[model samples]
Target: MGAGLSGLACAITLEKHGISPAVFEVRERLGDRFVNAESMLSILQKPITDPVAFFAEKNGIYLKPTASIQRLLVFSQSQKAEIEGSLGFINYRGRHEHAFERQLGRQVKSAIQYRSKATYEELLMEYTHVVVATGDGEYTRKMHNFRTDLTVSLKGAMVTGDFDRYTPCAWLDYSYMEKGYGYLLPLSDTEANLVMAYPDYPENDRLDVDERWGLFYERVCRDLRQPLRITSHFHVTGYPIGICRRARIGNTFFVGNCFGALMPFLGFGQFTALLTGIYAAYDICGKGAYEELTQPLRRSYENSLVLRRAVERLDNEDLDRIVPVLGSRWGESILQGKSFNALRWLAFALRPWMTKR
Candidate 1:
């Protein structure tokens, strides 16, 4: 129903199969006003395949990237570790069409009903099949009685700093941050994006988001020893991330963050969004392969939930121990979607249960 990345992807996939599709978007323009730069990790692990290229070769769909993140500066609550690796390709999610949507929009000549607001009821009344690509699915949530919800309270700002465009900091501190972490993504030598996101915690219940962002920025500077200054900040968008019980309801399907396709560990969803959208298209074509194709992603998302719970229970000492593992080869493998250390992950997941609140 919506024409963001997933919605557009759904439409493009249908069109590829010789089916004409109509799209509706709530916003006048796509990818505008959703502020953030995303990292697209390659679907292939070893030799690190490019996600855009992989999609192009496999689905006849392609995406362009604005920047590539080359290195990672990871920090525990107190300890610091730097790793030379490809975090992912970074694309600007400015107040306009992002790299992916712009490329897809050009390829598919769909009559997008811009500024159109159609309810699910309205959609079902006309179309034989409805694909709900509404990013955040409020209706689906209510319909399914899905209970799990995590708050990703994020604040972004343009900051002037002498920084390496390829190197960014990912700060994880269960102390001040509780269940959240902060990041610094440099777009250029003088301009960078600072974002902090964490699950819901009571420690920040009373503080305003601006105050919280100030602390987060200050902590990033202190940890990295960078004296960058925030030129301006944007309003905080603390949205909920949860797994949908089902993406399909009768003839309607959900994709993207609406179905909680984002990784539960760090809340990256672009890959899942695209994958699910294409699968939804397959389902509509009578293939019904959406569930089979997206099964691995669902398992990974569930695994991330376990990891998130473990992070919540960890103390400053535990975080110090955890930081090094994340910088090691094993951690790199885990990040690349290569393999998971089941025993180690289980230990982390069970650590929280040892102590009671």
Candidate 2:
């Protein structure tokens, strides 16, 4: 029902199957929001070395990445680690020509109704089938199908800096934030996205976002040995990270975040979101079953929750001990190897830890 990545992808797939569907959006245009960058880690999407190429060849969905992520730098309170390999790729998001939403929107043939205030109840009375891709879980929650695992607060800014386009950095420190992390993803050689995300639990209800940001920013500047000028910034609070118990209810289908495509551990779901959209279209065309198509994605989301729970139980000391392991030869092999699903194994290994906590 929306014109974001998943909705646009759904429309494009439906058009390819000779079915023209109506698309609507509340925003005046595609990518109508704050501009930023996001990463698509190959390790997160195992067995698929190149996501851009995989989408194009396997699903007929084409996309362009801003840069290839060849290295990752992670810093804990008392330890720093570096991992180098064919990590992943970074892509621009939000209101830009290269943003994923605009890229997908340009592929649609039918006209999209902007500023749409159409309700699901009203749309249900008209269309034979309704696909909810509203970019959030509000509608699913209203139906009593969503299970929220956690709510997080995020503060980010676009900064001008001398950045390595191929390198992404992360920080883990309890002094500034509890069970939270900071990261930098370069949009280009001269600009990057710097962000901090932490849980918005009762224990952190009294924390000051600005004060935390100040600490994180200072640490990043010292680590990089350079000052970054903020070009723009955004802060989001109480953003839910969760899943829908049912993917399809009656003739209504849920895709994207509405279908629980977001991973709780790192909040990555672009690839999965796009896939759900395409899968919904396939089900509409009698080419596949939506439930069966999204089974693996749902499984991945549940698996990631295990890691998220484990991370939530960790302290700065635990992070310090783990960051070194991530940079070791064993860690490198686990990340770079394609023989087995490292994420699955890691999640399985951490399941007991999570349960004990």
Candidate 3:
């Protein structure tokens, strides 16, 4: 039960089938507590093919699709590479609900009970089917014991400044220690997103998030040969940047970063969250309106586990090589080809379970 993109999507899907899904969100707003803009790649890959459009159409809302498509610059521990693809970009929800959050909110506004949190006992007593979308590990202890955990640690900082020079350049620098990388994604001409992760790095273990971010920000500026003009700063908003221990449990389903967030190396979890939610919707509908739908939830959860493993492998291997070569002439050449696009699409289609919607 959450109000984030995943939970909203799940609720909307159920309502679409006339099931009248009830949502319990811990927060008051449709989006989570975080302030940074998330990256969307696949589900919104194309304007017409995007789920935002689908939800808007079904719910009678006007959602204007904004395309900030660009190639991903992967920074591996060892080298750099460029991944070419049609990346889908959307703002979650802010005002008029023009982004991902607004579209999903419009679908399930009446169903969601904002500021109402559900405990284990309270949840089991209420809905006949409970879908757990909260990003809290403590809540799932008794009912679900998921062994899936992440090794990497995630830390981030949001800065509002002129990133105009790096707008489309979106650099992914991996000059950090082994299994660590720095990211620079441009949200707009005035906004830039910076995130860094370390799988085994423990520099922040001894210090609080602010202190660690202070040190990290200093380092990033030094490397970039620039000054830190942070008009606004939000750093290391959360801790222990690892995947969730479990995804699905009994009649409850999980989606989004709650299941397991991919490492920053992939930078596709935002897209994955929406895709997984859609897939969960499909699974629920396929089983028909009955408690028997729990079976498909289990299968989807198992499938997520397998996909997470593959992602771990990719993070540990390809990323170290890919990050260094981003934004280069060679990277541009690779992205300009149609063969790479075909291969990427085929690869995702080949693994239906892992495909990002």
Candidate 4:
């Protein structure tokens, strides 16, 4: 029902099957939000290495990534690690000329009703089938279908800096915020998106976001050895990271974050979100069962949740030890290998460490 990635993908898929569907978006235009960049990590999407190729060849959904992620630099409180490979791809999100939403918007033939206040109840009375891709869990929550694992507070900005377009950096420091992480994904040689995400637990309710961001920003500058100037910024609080218990109820289908596409581990769900939308379209076309098509994605989400729980038990000392391992041959093997499930193995491997401290 929304014109975000999943909604547009749903419309495109329906169009491919000769079915024209009405699309609605809450925003005035596509990409009408803060500009940022997100990674489609190959390590996260195992067995299928290249998400861009996989989407086109498997689902007939073609998408262009901003750049191939060839290197990953991770920093802990006392350790730094670098991993190099065809790690993944980066895609610009939000308001940008080449943003993912705009790209998907271009592929759809149907007109999207912007500033749409159309509710699901009203739509249900008209359309034979309704696909809820509102890009959030609110509607699902209202239906008593969403199970929230945790809520996160995020502060991010588009910054001008000297950056390596092929490399993404991550920071794991608890001094600024507990169980929080920061990342930098370059849009180009001179521009990048820097973001910090942390759990919005009750204990953190009184924490100052600006103070935390300031510390994180300084750390990034020191680590990169380049001062960055903020071009634009965004802040979000109490953003739910969870799943819907039911993907569908009656003729209504839920895709994207509405259907629990956001994984708890790192919260990246673009690949799963696109697949769910396509799967919903497939089911609508009598080609497959939506629930069955999305079973693997649900499994991945569960696996990520387990990993997130294990990671929650770790402290800065634990990260100091683990960061180096991530750059080691064993870690490289796990990340590079395509045969086994990397997420599952990672969660399993963290069991001992999680119990130790």
Question: What's the TM-score of every candidate structure?
Answer: 0.88, 0.97, 0.66, 0.96
lDDT of 4 by residue, 61-169 (tens): 7788889999999999989999988999999888887888998898899888999999999999999999999988889999999999998888899999898999999
Off by over 4 Å in 2: none
Q: lDDT ranking from best to worst?
A: 2, 4, 1, 3
Candidate 1 Cα lDDT to native: 0.73
lDDT of 2 by residue, 99-143 (tens): 999998888999999999999998999998999999888899999
Q: 103-200 in candidate 3: lDDT tens per residue?
A: 66876745678789567568878777676667543455444554334445556655665554222333233334333456665666666657665554
Best-matching candidate per lDDT: 2
Find the candidate with the highest TM-score and give its number: 2
Candidate 2 lDDT score at position 125: 93
Q: What clash pairs does model 2 have?
A: none
- Candidates arranged by TM-score, highest first: 2, 4, 1, 3
Candidate 1 segments whose C-alpha is farther than 4 A from its true place: 42-49, 223-225, 329-357
Q: What RMSD does each model have against the real structure?
A: 3.3, 1.2, 6.5, 1.9
Question: How many residue pairs clash in model 4?
Answer: 0
Residue-level lDDT for 14 in candidate 3: 66
Q: Candidate 1 residues 1-357, lDDT tens each? A: 888778888899999888888898888877667455667754322233567676789888878776676778888867887666665777766463555776778777668888887887898999999988887767777787344567677767878888888887888875445677787887767777888776656776655766767777788787767788877666555577787777677888878877667776677788778878888999988767676766766666776676666667677788799889867887766655534445345645665663343
Worst 10 residues of 4 by lDDT: 348-357
Clashing pairs in 1: 32-96, 180-198
